[model samples]
Structure formats: structure tokens, C-alpha cells
Target: MTSVNDQTQIEQETGNTEGESKDSVKQEKEMKPEESNANSPTELSKLTKIVKHSKPEQPLGFDGFKKQYYRYASKFGTTLNLLVVGGSSLGKTTFVNSLIQGSLTGKKTAKTSDFMQHRLRMTDGDINFNLTILDTPGFGEKCDNSNCWKPLANILVQRLNAYFENEIKACRQLPIVDTRIHGCLFFINPTGHMLDPLELYVMKRIDRFVNIIPVIAKADMLTPEECARFKRNIIKDLQHEHIQFFHEPGKSIEGINYGMPEPFALIGATKGMQSDSKNAIRGREYPWGVINIDDPQHSDFCAFRNFLLYTHAEALIEKTHKVIYDALRTERLNKLKSQPNGFYTSSKKLVEEYMKAELGRVERSLRQTVQDKLQEKENLLAYTEKQLEAKHKEYEESLINRCNELKSQKQSLENLVRSDKTKKHSIFFK
Candidate 1:
């Protein structure tokens, strides 16, 4: 242990170990920065690529536009309802045909007709909607026109009641199809005077419920001077009677001087006749001259059409829901809430009756379902019994055949024994 050579070897070994440790330290120092980078997010940041996004400069194609349009249509259900009210021979069908460009599918209604509804798919660019036109053919045409507006009002109220019932249902359908009258186009006769008593009564009664747009039908029958005077008198009469028409209030009345206000003068013609200039025009070719229906100077048909179909279309729909429909709904709810004891009792009795009927229906359905299941089970049981009876008969026949075979074997054995005995006796005698 005290040898100089041993001491020298130990010192050499120690020196070698120290030198190897120093080399490892130097290598670890060189990898320190790389290890730090691996632990940090710097490497990930370097690998990521950055992109600059911007709005598309080019417009979408027709297909993409249609997709977007349908998306919008889905967001907002599009169904337009229009109520047309007029007397007999007012050319309501002709006006509808002309407006829709010969796309009406319903048969032409007669002078005395009931409430008829027609549907058409209207398209504007990529957006599409359903247009429902309701025609009241015999309105105000009766000799006793006193109760003419009652049917129309009752129909309107019925639709509102149906919508209200659906709204208050326990489970309501998504996106209720609105069948309420959004607008009423009331056609007035071109008598070149003022509004008749019947017309005033109907307008005043229904104006609060719907957007009324009074149009003077067959304006071609009246001269220009007569038309202007009639329009003025009609406006004065409407204002005097406090009748509400579809005029955008809160807006300036400056357009009144520029164009006829409130009541519109219209001439409806389905057939086209050539003008003096040989141009095809939609108007009446009278003995004196041709009156172009689309001309602003000749008639207000173009302005009224634009107002109804394009400009104020959304307004009419919005007002119907926001003003008329909502008011009716609120009133109904209030009535239900404010009912007295007797009325409440009656209503409760009615509700009980309805619930009893509904419960009876449900019970009948459930009983039918149970009866059907029982019948199925009975049929299966009958089939099983038949199979069991057939198998039992087959087993009994098989047992009977086996028993007969065994009896024949026994008889054969007896016959053999008798023969053997007889042979033995003969042998003994011999």
C-alpha cells in the first residue's frame, strides 16, 4: 500500500479520469444552447408559416350566389299574402294575369264567386319566394251590400285565430307559415265622382286590419280631366271619412304634388294592342285613341305595381306582423286574462270538453294498438295449436303401426311353437 509504483499508478488513473470529465463538460457546454432551443418555443415559431388574409376581390359565381341566397331565404321564410277585394266585373283576374306575366294557373273566376286562393313562385335575382293571392270575387256585388265585408273580416279573424292557436301550442312548429292578409288591394269603380257609401263602409271597416290600397279600376273609361277630378274627390272623401290607406307616414308629403296621393288610378288589360307608333302596348284601344296602362302620364298602374311588388313590399309585410297581427294577438291574450267569472267558467268548460275529446281520441288509438297486438298473438297461438295437433296425430299413427307389427311377430312365434310340437310328437311315435 505504501509502494511508490502503486502511488504513481493511482495518480495516473486519477489524471485520466479528470481529463475524461473535462472533455464531457466541454461537449455538454457546446449542446447547452441547442437544449435550451429545444425546450423553448423558438423552433416551433420558425416552422410555422404566416399567411395574410383579405376579403375576396372577385364576386361569387351564380351557383355560389344562389347558395348564399337560399341561406338567406332559410333564415327568413318568404311567403307573401295579398287579398284582392272588388265588386263584379272589376277585371281583378285580368290585373293579376297582367301583373304576373301570364303565369296564373287558376281558372278564371265568375262574377259570383267565393274566396279562392292561388299560389305562384316569384323570383328576384337569386332569391325566390311564394306569392299567395286571395280573391274575394262577390264582395260588394250583392244588392244588399250591408253584410259583404263580414265574410272577409271573419276570414281574416279566422286566420289570425289559427296562427294564434299555433303560436300558443305546447310544441309549436318551426317557422310558422303566415297566412294572414298582408295587403288588401281594394278596386274602386271609375265613376268619375267620389267613393260610394258601400266602398267607404268596407274600407273603413277593414282598413284597421290590413294595408288597404284603393285603386280606381277601368280608368280608361274616364277622360284625363275627369280622372284627375275623380282622384281629387276620392282623396278628399277618404280624408274626410278618416279612412287609413297604405301611405308611408313620418315621411315628407312633398311627393303628393309630384304624383297623385293615396288612391291610385289603374287600368288593367291582359291583351296587348299596338299603338299609333306600331309599338305593342298594354292598354285599351278606344275609338278615340290608345291609353297605355304602363305610362305614368296615362295611368298610375306602373307606379302602383312598383309600389306593391317592389318598393313597399317589405313594408306591408312588416306592418302586418308588427302592427296588425301583434295588436290582435295582444288583444286576445288580454281578453283571456280579463275574463269575468261566468266567461271564465264557460271557457274552462270548453277547454275541459276539448281535453276530454282529445283524451278519448288518444285512448281509442291506444286501444286499437293493443287490439292489433292481441290479434297478432291470437293468430300465432292458433298456428302453434294447429302444428301441435298435427304432430300429435302423426305420433299416435306411428305408435299404432309399431304395435301392430309387434302383434304379428307374437302370432308368428306362436305358429312356430305349434309346428315344432307337432313334429316332436311324430318323431316319438316313429
Candidate 2:
């Protein structure tokens, strides 16, 4: 049933298609790589680029550096220094103990005002942290709490001074142990009212140098509603007073309370009371039931703790280094700018310059004093010589006058003798 002509046409068509495909393939093979590039702008841009699809042999990722840093940190643990200041009987000690359990031994105190520093090693998440807790006793406890902020301010200045000391060394220490106060937890008494004058003054005074975390201590004493009201009142008071706390700077906008609890209401757990629950959480024992410090309904302890350690630990440190520490550093540098060559000099270098200048001044002063004394002695001697010459001249003149007078007297006597001889005065002639 097949026609020979149709079959021949089909064969010719198939042959022609094969030849065309072969020709196109040959043309593609013959064309140079650049010649085959598209004429469209997008295609031309991509094809005309001299780069290759594969990345070169250069190492790009920071993973190696990151790992090295991590290893270094693990070897020598990271440090976090926290200063806790509050009035007496405000659970300062208890809260510190609970913050890093079993880290302290036998209340090692600083030289100032019952100020205790408990240094210990602890781990938070992956970081092996050397945590230092600075506690202040007898602060704001007196009837006249006006000058209470001084002691607190002194401690902060000491820490900053300490860092400055290490920083200015000729051969700087390999790892400058950063003992600067990273954060200050000011334990406000939970009166369910606004902050008092002393509290506000103390906070405002040191808040410039360190991060001040306004905490409502003994929050367990206040009811939920009362605690909430107190937090609000404290915020309003701080806002009204125009006080800056740690939380203020981290906030994206003004008058906004961010993720962290502002004026954190905290209830420190006492060992005397253990919860009757299966978990046996630490809390205060009440007549009716037990109050768990971890319970959010009870206090802001858990939230505060998490915020302190995990959530915003870096933020606190960052603010300290970037804002607080930088401000202090700039201030100190500005002060030092008054010194000779202090603008370009390190603190130690400035001190050395000052000492050299002082010594030079003393030497110059000594030389000048010695020169003055020598000049004075020379002038005195010259004056004495001149006076002696004038005295000698006067004596010579008097001697000549005396001689002349004597001669005149002798002559007169001679004439008198002659007259006496002439007048028969024998005794006068002898």
C-alpha cells in the first residue's frame, strides 16, 4: 500500500533535516566562545564578565578565626563584673548568693564601707565566666542619706581607674583583666511607691559610668497588683526625674519599655523555706502556702535572672564597653589633653612626660636659684670693695689735713719759741 514517490519524499525530507542538524552543530563547534555570546544587555553582561563560576583558592569564611577565639575564651574564661548596691536589709546579700550559688566563701570585702567583692568561676550556657559580685552594705540606711552616693561613686571610679592603670602600661598586659563594673543592680525597696530622693540621686550619680538596673527588692512583700503598680510608679518617677537606667538606652524609641523588665520586682529566696512541691523550688514559706521565687506570679526573679545571664548579658557588656566605658575613656583623655603631649600620648606616657617636665622644672629652678645667689654674693663683694676704697680715700684726705694742721701748729710753735727766746723765755726754747 505504500507509494514509492511518497517514500522517496519522506527519505529526502529526513536526509535534509539530518544535514541541517549537522550543519548547526558544526557551526556551533566552529564559533569562538566570545562570538557565541548573546547580544542582549543582561546576557552580554553575564557572558562578558571575566570571572569564573567557581570560587578561587582564597580563604573567605571567618569560621577559623571564630573557632580560634572560642578556643581562647574556653581556655581563659570570659569575665563579668556586677556591682549590687542597695539599702540595708534589702536582700542584697541573699540575692547575690542566689545569683551564683556556692561561688563565694567568707565574705571578702573591699577596703571601702563594708563593700564586699565575691569572685567566683561559673558557667552560663557555653561561656566559662569569672563572675564578680560587688555588694554594698549600710548604704542609704542612715537618717542622712544625702552623701550615700559618694561611696558608690568612689567604687565605680576606682574600677575605671584600675582599668586605666592597666591600659597605660608600657608593655601592655596580654589579657587586661577587665574588672570594670559591667552592670549595677540598684535594689529599690518595694514600698509600692515612687523612688525616694536618696535612691534617685544615687542611681543618677553612677548611672553615667555604669549600667543601673533599677530593681524592686522584697517584691514578695507586695501583692501582684501592688507590684505592678509599683513598677509603673517607679517608671513614671524615673521618667519624671529624667533618670537613665540600663534599659533606657537599649530601647528603640523614647518612652518605650522593651523586652527586658524595667524596675524589675525581685524576691530573693531564703534557705529557711523550701517549696513543698515535688520540684522543691526555693521560696519564702507562708502560713497558707509556699511562695516560689521562680513563679512569675510571685516575683520577677526568674525573668531578671534570665535577662542578666542569657538574654541580654552581651547587651549589658556591649553598652558598658561602647557607651559607658567609651564615655569615661573620652572624658579621661580630654582631661589628660591638658598635659604636655597628652593628646597623642598614653596615660602612662603622659605621666612619664609630666614627671620629666617636673624634674626639668626643678632642675631649672635650682640652677636659677644658685645663679641668683652667686650673682647676689658677687654684687655684695663689689659693693663692699667700692665702700672700702671710698673709706680709704677719706682716711688719706683726713691724714693729709691732719699733717698740714700739725705742720702749721709746729711753725706757730717755732715762731712762739723764737719769740719766747727773744723775750728771754729759756724754758720755751728748750
Candidate 3:
């Protein structure tokens, strides 16, 4: 019996020991998961990983960008006016069509024997452009092109005069739609020689009033060597004649090689065909391979395009306003001042009208200035009056408080005197 009792005791001890070992193993296993979590990357690191892998929201596409630009332009009231001036059959019409990116078949600038202006409005992407192509027909075509440039000169002067007249008028439209020629693109025939007399004459006459950009028309007619020589000659001639092309002062002239030589060699092609490389080139087909109009090696059309539309559009407009138009206005005013009073009766009346308008403008300005000063003074006086009123109220309140304190002191003094008398009487009675 003793041996059996000892065996039961041993079995209970072993079972308890085994259960403790098992519990310790299970605890270690649970703790292992927590240890692993602690060893892993931090929460911030995991968030960074997610951010690096996730796709960001895309930006607005071309159409959306154009609409946004248009909205801003409309709100600000801005427009580009381009005037294309070139002789007939010099790809002027073709160039205009290309600029507007239209397929108006057989729609050319009015090709009259005389100089004429054709008006067309075009909108590309977000930009709205008012295009005026001044076609000078029979310019160099005549045998005696002596005074051929006079018509164009007259047109520019007429525009200036009209603008001046509008300025002198009492009532005028708001944000006046400026019709003055901002830019003139003069086309030179690709003769691989210097500029013709007619081009030089026209350029000299209009360069002061407008920004002239010389173009070597039909550049593909000349070879590369010939084109280079032609460009050099044109530059030399322009420098000798003291003619100025479109160039902005105080602006960097870097990275514009093809345009710096002055007359940009250009080619305009309205037709195109697919080549073996599956590229549609707008060029004339020869026995050899194709010559792309946009290819820089072939022509400077791309360079000229960038210069016209991107680099100098705003500068041209600014120059016209500040330099050309302002100078013209000053000259007109000076002329009006110099004219005799009695002679040229119509001229005298016009000058008188202009002077009257000027006087009215000055009077209105002076009146406005006086009114503004008076308003400022009134505001200052009102502020001072308010301050004075507030100070007066404070002073009155302080005076009333002091008066009350004095009255209280007087009553207290009277009471004290009566108490002293009472004390004295009590002492006497005692």
C-alpha cells in the first residue's frame, strides 16, 4: 500500500511540472508575435512606402488648359493684332492661311492693282487674333516703282490720325479696339541677292510706325550655300541703310541664330504627301527625296513662327503703344501748336478743337485732384471730431467722480467733528 501511494504522488508531481512547461512554451509563442511586430518598420515608414507607390492626380490636359487661358484673357480684355504686309505671289496669302490654320480654298487676300487691306479674325487655342493683311499689289511689278511705297505709308499715317482723332473726342468707346498696325511682315523674293529698291523703300517708310520682320520668301528655291550668302548680303544691306528689324532692347538675344541674321529664310507649302517613313511633309516633290517645310535644316519657317507668335508678340504691342503711338501723338500736338491761327481755316478749326479737348482733359484732372484732397481732409476732420468728443466725455466723467469724492469727504469730516464734540462732552461729564 505504501508503494502504490508513492507512485500516485510521483505521477501528480510530473503532471504539474509538464503543465507548467507547456504554459511557459505557449507564453513564449504569444510573445514572439509581439517581438516580431516591434522589430518591423515604423508606421511612418509604411506610410512613406504607400505614398511612393501610389499614383498622383493628373494635371489638366490641353483642352482644359486652353479654356482656362481663354477665361483669363476675356476677363482681362487682351487681343493680338497682326498685320501681314508683302507683295503679291510671294507666298503672303499662303502664309496667312497657314497662320490661321484654315482650309479656305481659293480665299486669297484682295489682289487688286492697287494696295488694299483685308480684314480677318482668327482664334487659335485660347488666343483671339485680329489679323489684317495689307496687300500691296504691283509694288515691284511696275517699271517705275518710284513712289510705290506711298500708299502703304499713307495707310499707316491714316491709322495714326484716326487714333489721335478718337483720343481728342469727348465721348469714346471703352478699351478702344486698337486698329493700328502692330507688326508688318515684309517678304523679300529669294533672289540670293540684296534687298530690292522697292523693299528698302517700303521698309524705311514704315519701320518707324510698325515692327517690320523681313522674310526671305520661297527659300526652298535657293540651295543651302546660296541661302547663307543671301542672308549675309541682306544683313549687310540693312545695316548700311540703317534699317531696324523687330528687336526688343534690354532683352536677351541668345539662342536665336536663324532669326538674328534679320531676314528669316522661309518656305510656305500648302500641300503634303506621306513619305516612306510615314511622315507627312508639307513640301514640293522632286526627283530626289522630300523637303519638309518645318524642318530647320530645310528652312527657317519654324524659327520665324516662334519669333512671331511666342517671343515678340507682347513686345510688339508694347512698342506700338509706348514708342510709335506716343511719338506720333507728340508730333501731332507740336504741329497743332506751330500752325498759324488765321491761315488754313479748316486746319485751324481742327487744331482749335484738339486744343479745347486738351484743355477740358486738364480741367477735369485738376477738378478730380481737388475733390480727392477735399475728401481726405473731410475724413481727417471727422476722425479728429470723434476723438475730441470721446475725450470730452472722459473729462466730464472724471470731473463728476471727483465732485462726488469731495462731497463724501465733506460729510465724513462733519461726522468726525460731531463725534469729537460728543467725546469731549462725555469726558467733561465724567
TM-score, each model? 0.58, 0.61, 0.57
Candidate 3 lowest-lDDT run of ten: 47-56
Residue-level lDDT of model 2, residues 351-424, one tens digit each, is 45544654576569779999999999999999999999999999999999999999999999999988877778
- Of the two candidates 2 and 3, the one with more favorable lDDT, higher being better, is 2
TM-score for candidate 1: 0.58
Where model 2 places Cα greater than 4 Å from the true spot, the runs are: 1-69, 102-113, 124-126, 248-258, 272-274, 341-430
| Clashes (candidate 2) | 0
* Every candidate's lDDT: 0.72, 0.72, 0.67
Encode model 3's per-residue lDDT on 297-352: one tens digit a residue.
88888877787667776677887889888997887778767778623224345445
- Tens-digit lDDT string for candidate 1 (293-372): 88899888888877776667778899888998898778767867788751432333433454465457656977999999
The pairs that clash in candidate 2 are none
Q: Best by TM-score, which number? A: 2
Which candidate order results from sorting by TM-score in descending order?
2, 1, 3
